[model samples]
Target: MQNDLVSIITPSYNSEKFIAKTIESIINQTCENWEMIIVDDCSPDNSNEIIENYMQKEKRIKLIKLKKNSGPAIARNMAIEQAKGRFIAFLDADDIWLPEKLEKQLLFMKENDLSFTYSAYRLIDEEDNDLGVFIPPVLADYSSLLKTNFIGCLTAIYDTNKIGKMYMPNILKRQDYGLWLKILKQIKSTKGITEPLAIYRIRKNSVSSNKLKAAMYQWKIYREVEKLNIFQSMYYFMNYAYYGLKKY
Candidate 1:
């Protein structure tokens, strides 16, 4: 088995409230052959300080502080430039991962010779508590991708040799979604595991928590950005609506 290094890139801004839990999850991962690069986007709060304290104790954790408040996409791209791993993974500042996340995802990627893969994720509350269970579709091809972005960003892992580093989109909200589309266009196939590997925190104040705004951005991606026609837009829009309705 080829054991390639996995680099976890996290972009943060004023995330002191959850950054520690996020870092601790990485510290406790069963797959230890991984390094975490945390890019702090000039957080006005103590986020950088908290990360610095952890970095003192853990060599695998590296922190990059920005000079100004750039969006998460810019922060992620900066971290990607510094990544040294053969496999690339992403973790939001507020999310947590199970210990076997990297181990299981890596095994699946290598065994299938898959260029990239993502898995289902569980939703968590603001207090690091589980909301319930949610599993994504076992995406086998691009057609499934068009139906919905069932592949959770936090659960995604990819072989850098085949797909290369994720190009962080300038668009703020749906940056991960955009990269997934771009990468899917390059790779022959992409898949997702049925198991939940990460915890997606749904904070009441998060950008994603706003249904209307989220839908607007989703519409922009499907209609304007991807430039899908009306019929194609409705097909994906309905898939989005189905998932949104299921949340309640």
Candidate 2:
């Protein structure tokens, strides 16, 4: 499909502290045929200036600034709309990828003829200290993923040639999970690579770090987004809670 070209979608908002390092990580990737589309949601900081500096030096880096501040869902969707590569991937503004991440993951997908693939990743604190690796299910389908989300958006890649361009739901939280579920509904399952190819930054007091809030958002996903009945939602919510404890 597009000769293995990968489009990296990044949504940024006031990410001055780690955005430079994140962009550098991509600059150093072993895979060369890729375009990184970064969308800024009216960041009230120097994030735009830093990205603009990169655009001058790097032609592969494209930046889009929204007129008003939007959430990650809209920002990512804007990047996705501009993406031209056959492979759609995600990397947040604060995360860093290993040099071999794109190269290795692309090969993994092509070699196995897989449409969707995600990998394991290690976590880093605000100071970039290692927090340990999180392994996802080796193979996850729609039903199993309904229990808990194992695919980290930072490590996920889906081939547009195989499944077409899929966008995330317009929710404030758990948008990645919604996209993964939509993709799984189209395909049978997605393969997982256990190698830690990316680094996820865990910022203190981040909204996503709240377990109760995450659970509630996940419940809304099951009820409103997926539209499962009461009994089904409860059944899956139990699995989600158990796996949540085991995940982080």
Estimate every model's Cα lDDT from 0 to 1. Answer: 0.84, 0.93
Model 1 score (lDDT): 0.84
Best by lDDT: 2
Q: Please identify model 1 stretches exceeding 4 Å from their true place.
A: 1-3
State every prediction's TM-score relative to the real structure. Answer: 0.93, 0.98
Candidate 2: the clashing residue pairs are none
Question: Candidate 1, residues 1-248: lDDT per residue as tens digits?
Answer: 23488889999988999999999999999889999999988888998889999999999999998898889989988988899999889998999998999989988988888988888888989876778767776665655676666777788877888777767678878888877877877774667788888899998977678989988888888876678999988988898888788756
Count of backbone collisions within predicted model 1 = 0
Q: Which candidate number maximizes TM-score?
A: 2
Model 1, C-alpha of 90: deviation from truth (Å) = 0.4
